[model samples]
Target: MSSLSMASRNLRRRKARTILTVSGIVVGVALIMVLLALTEGTATQTNGLIREILPAQVTIVNATTPTGSGAGIRALFSSGYNLNQSTVAEIAGLGGVYAATGQLSSTAYLNGQTVLLAGIDPSSYPLATNGLSIQSGTSLSTAPSDQVVISDTLAGQLSISVGSRVTLGPNSTGGAPYTVVGTFSSSTTFLDRSVYIPLSNAQGIAGEQGKVSEVYVKVVPQENASTVAAEIQDKVAGVRVVTSTNIATAVSSLTGTLTTVFAVIGFVALLAGGFGVANTMIMSVAERTREIGTLKAIGARSSQVLKIFIGEAFLIGVVGGAAGVAIGAATSLLLSSLGGGAGAGGLGRGARLFSGVLAPAITPELVLLSLALGIGVGVVAGIYPAWRASRMDPAEALRHV
Candidate 1:
C-alpha cells in the first residue's frame, strides 16, 4: 500500500478525534469566507449604486473653511451653503455642460413618521430624463403647486395612494397638507423613500426661498467628466466638485477598512484551528510509534514517514475546507435574504442599511483563497509532528509501549 493510503487508514482508525480536528478547521475557514463575502459584496453593491445614481454627473457641494491652525483641523461643514436659480443657469451656460438642476432637501414628518423630502426642478433633473417614471398619476410638470410625488415604498409605509392628501412637517396644526399627485419608481434606494415636490414649494415650506442645498450637473456626452468637473470648480466659487468615480472610490475605501478589521478576526479563528490540527497530529504520532518503526524496518525512509503524516493532514484540510465553503455560502445567502426583506418592508434604519443593496456576494476567488489557506494551515501545523515521527530511532520506536 502507498504511504498516503496507509495514512488514510490510520486516520480512519480514530474517527472521533479526526472529526473533532476537522471541525476546528471547518469553523476557521467558514469564518474567513463569510467575512470576505460580506466586505466584497458591500463594496460591489455600493459601487453599483453610485454608478446608477451619479453616472456622468458632477455633484457640487459647499466648500470647506479653515477652523484652526492645525493642518487637519479644517472644518468642512456646508451648513450655510445655498445655491440659487442663477447659479444653476450659470452652470447650464458653462462649456461642456448639457444641463443643470438645483435640489433642496430637508426632513419632515408625514402622518407622525419622519420622511425625506427633496425639491427639484423636474424639467432639468437627470432622473426625469433617465430611468425615473411615474407608476401612477401625472408628472410634476402638470401637477399643481400643492401636489407632490412620492416613492412607492414610502406610499406603502404611509398607506396613502394617488389623490391622497398627506400632511407634511410637524402635524396638522404646524404642517402643510399636500395632495399625492404621483408615485414614482427608480433604481435607487434613497429615491425610493423620498418625496419630490417642485423646487419653489420645497423652498417655501423650508423657509429658505430661492435657496438650494446642492446642484446636479450633467456634462456634454463627448467631454471628459474630470475635465468638466475641473472647469466647473474654476468657474464656480465656494463649491466642491466631485465626479461619480470619486464617490465609488470613497465607498471602496470604506469597505476595504471593514474587510481588514474582519479579516483579523478570521485570522484569530484560523490560528486556533491550526493549534487543534497540531495537537491532533502530535497525538497521532505518539499512537503510531510502533507502526513507524515497522515501516522503517521494512525500508521506509525518513522522508517517506514525513510525507505520510503531512499527507494525512492535507487530506483532513481538503475535506474540512470544502464543507466550510458550502456552509459559509449558505449562511451568507440566508442573512442577505433576511436583511433584504426587512429593508424592503421598511422595518428599521439599521435593517434598511443592509437590505438589498448590501447583500453578501460569494466569489470564486474567495472560495479558492479560503481553501488554500485551510490546506496551508494543515501543512504548517503538521510540520513539527511529521519531523518528530521522521527523526525517531527505529529501535526505540519499536520498543515503545
Candidate 2:
C-alpha cells in the first residue's frame, strides 16, 4: 500500500487516540478563527465608518501648541483657536474648493439625557456627500431657528420623533426649547448618536456667537486633495488641516493594533495545541515501535516511515482545521447578532463599542490562513516524533514489548 494509505490505516486502528489529538487542534484552530474574524470585522467596520463620515473632505480644527509629547494628550488639551464666518468664506472662495462649512459642537442634556449637539450651517452642509440621509420630516433650511435634526439612534434613545419638541441644555434650562424637524440616518456610530441644529441656534446656545469650533472643506473633483490641504494650511493660519487620507490612516493604525493584539492571543493558544499534538505523536511512536521495525525490515526506508507519520499528522490537521472553521464562524455570527442590539438602551461609550462589532466578516484570506496555521502546527509537532520513528533500530525495536 501507498505511504498515505498506510498512514490512514494506522490512524484508523487507533481511532480514539487520533480523535483526541484532533480535538485539541480543533479547539486551538477554532479560537484563532474566532479572534481573526472579530478583528477583521472590527477593522472593516471602523474603516468603512471613517470613510463614510469624512469622504472627500478636509477637516480644519483649531491649532494649539502641544503641552505633552503624545498626539492624544495634545488633542485632549488643545485650546484657544476658533474658526469664524470669515474663515469659512475664505475657504469657500479658494480655488478647487467645492463646499465649505463650519460647525459648532457642545454637550447638552436632551430630554434628561446628555447628547452630542452639533451646529451646522444648513445651507452649506454637505449632507449627501457626508452620507447623512434624511429618513423623515424636513431638513433644516435657512429658516432654521429652533428646528433640529436628530439621528435614528438618538430618536430611539430619547423616545422622540419628528415634530416632537425636546428640551436642551442642563436640565432643559440652558437653551431655548427646540423642535425636531427631521431624523437622519448615518452608518457611523458616533454620528448616529448626535443631534444637529442650525449653526445660528447652536452658536446662541453655546454662547459663542460668530464662532465655530471647526470647518469642513470639500475639494472639487479632479483636484489633488493633498495640494489643496497644504494651500488651506498656508492660507488659514492657526488651524490644523486634516485631509481624508490622514483620518483614514489614523483609523487604520488603530485597527491594525487591535488586530495584532488578538492575533498574538490566538497564536499562544495554537502554540499550546501544538504541544498537545507533539505529545500524542510521541506516544504513538512508542506504541508503533514494533510495527515500524517490521516495516523497515520488510523494505520500508526511513524516509517512507517519516512520510507515514507526517502524513498522519497532516490528515489530522486538515480534518481539525475544517471543523474548527465551521464552528468558529457559527459562533461569531451568533455573538454578533446578539451584540448588535446592545445600543438599544443608550448611545453611551460602552454601547458604541459593542455596537461597532455588529458582525463577523469572513474573508478568503482568513480561511486560508487558518488552514495553513493548523497544518503548519501539525507538521512542526510531528517532526521530532517522525524522526524518532524513522531512526528506530530494527533489531532492537522488533524486541519492544
Candidate 3:
C-alpha cells in the first residue's frame, strides 16, 4: 500500500483516540477564527457607516464648556446640549453653504410610551437627513397639517398609520394633536422609532416659538465641506462640532478594545489545542513502537518513519482547523442574534435612540486564521512523535509492542 494509505489504516486502528484529539483541536481553532473575523469586520464597517451618516462637511453636538471649545472631557460625562438657532442661521448664511437645517430635539413620549421626536425644517429637510422617504402613504409637506412622518417599526409599535390622528400633546400649553400624515421606512434608528415633523410643528408643540437644538449644514460645493465646517466650529457658539469620521473614530476605539480581548482569549484556546495535539502524537509513538521497529527491520528509513508520523499529525490538524473555524462563526452568529440581530436599538443619541451601529459580522478572514492556526498546532504536535519514530532501534523496538 502507498505510505498515505498505510498511515490512514493505522490511524483508523485507534479511531476513538484520534476523534477525541481532533475534537479538542477543532474547538480551539474555531474560537480563534471567529474572534479575528469579528474584529476586522467591525473596524472596517465602523469607518464606513460613520462616513455615510456624518459625511465630511457635517457637524454634530455634544455637551460643551463655558470657554467655547468642545467639552472634550465634559462630553464623556453628559450630552443633550443644545445648538443655537442664531449660530445655525449664521453658518447657513456662510459664503459656501448650499443649505443649513436646524435640529430641534427632545425626549418625546406618548403618555406611557417613550419615543424620540426630531424637528427639521421641512423646506430645508433634504439638506439635513439625506431625504425623508415615504414607504407607504403620501409624503408629508411642511404646510400646517400638524402632519408627521413615521417609520415602519414605529408604525408597528404604535399601531397607528396614515390618516390616524394622534395627540402630540400640549404645545407647551397642555395638549395638542399632530396628525400622522405618512409612514416611512428609513432603516435608521432615529427614523425607525421617530416622530418626524416640521421644525415649526415641533417648536409649536413644545411651547417654544423659534428655537433650534442642533444644526446640520451642507456645503454649497460639497468639496468645500471641510473648510466650511472649520469656519462653523471657529465661529458657532453652544455647538460641539462632529462629523461622520469622528463618530467612526469614537466607536472604533470601543470595538477595538473588545476585539483585542477576544483575540487574546482565542490565542489561549489555540495554545491549549496545541498541547492536546502534542500529547496525542506522543502517545501514538509510544503505542506503536513495535510496529515502527518492524518497519525499520523491513528496511524503512528513519526519515520515512518520521515523515509518516508527521503526515498523520498534519491531517488531523487540517481537519481540526476547518471544524474550529465553523464553530467560531456559529458562536458569533448566535451572540449577534441574541443582541437583536444588528438592529438600531440603542439609546446613545442626543435625547434620541439612533440605532446607527450594529454588532460585528463573521468573515473570510476568520476562516483563514483558523486554518493557519490549526496547521501551526499540527506541526508542533508531530515534532516529538516524529523524533522518537526516527530514533527507534529495530532490536529494541521489537520488544515494545
Q: What is the TM-score of each candidate against the true structure?
A: 0.80, 0.81, 0.83
Among these predictions, the greatest TM-score belongs to 3
lDDT of each candidate versus the true structure: 0.74, 0.74, 0.68
Model 1 TM-score? Answer: 0.80
Score residue 71 of candidate 3 by CA lDDT.
33
- On residues 364-390, what C-alpha lDDT tens digit does candidate 2 reach at each position? 999888888888888899899999999
Q: Clashing pairs in model 1? A: none
| Model 1 misplaced regions, further than 4 Å | 1-9, 12-20, 52-56, 64-80, 127-133, 136-138, 142-144, 169-177, 186-189, 298-307, 330-351, 354-358, 387-393
Misplaced by over 4 Å in model 3 are 2-20, 47-57, 62-80, 110-112, 170-174, 188-190, 207-209, 220-224, 341-358, 399-401
How far residue 261's Cα lies from its native spot in candidate 3, in Å, is 0.6
The C-alpha stretches of model 2 lying farther than 4 A from their native spots are: 1-28, 52-56, 65-81, 127-131, 173-175, 268-272, 295-307, 323-347, 350-360, 387-393
